[model samples]
Target: MPQIFRIVPYSIYFWSNESDPLEPIHVHISEGRATSNATKIWITSTGKTVIKVLGENPG
Candidate 1:
């Protein structure tokens, strides 16, 4: 995993292998070590952000 940045107890990163279908340009955020169900933040071409909370309770 490539870490983009960290804030407090969270890590924002991207999986090197990525997903099979390949999501758009996105990053995952999670507490401590990154998880498979980490929240995904997608970046649109227009510079808008779309957040997807995997599993549950990513807050």
Candidate 2:
């Protein structure tokens, strides 16, 4: 199961991490049960906040 970080009532964030390696500091956002790619992200502050669109990987 994946963990979810709530940013607000309408938006949620999740960190991107893999088993072997992880992606550059990035976050996944969603409106609800929908896909994260549908959500847009914005970065605020230096090396502090990062917002971006969430996407699914093909296996």
Clashes of 2: 0
Which parts of model 2 have CA positions greater than 4 angstroms off? 11-22, 34-46, 53-59
TM-scores of all candidate predictions against the true structure: 0.85, 0.36
lDDT (10s digit) by residue, model 2, range 1-59:
14356544444454445335644544445555535354445445575665444465221
TM-score of 2: 0.36
State the C-alpha lDDT per candidate.
Answer: 0.86, 0.47
Model 2 lowest lDDT segment of ten: 50-59
Report the C-alpha displacement of residue 3, candidate 2, in angstroms.
2.8
Clashing pairs in 2: none
Clashing pairs in 1: none
User: Evaluated with lDDT, which candidate comes out highest?
Assistant: 1
Put down candidate 1 lDDT per residue, 1-59, tens digits, no spaces.
Answer: 88989997889999876878877899999988888898899999999999999864344
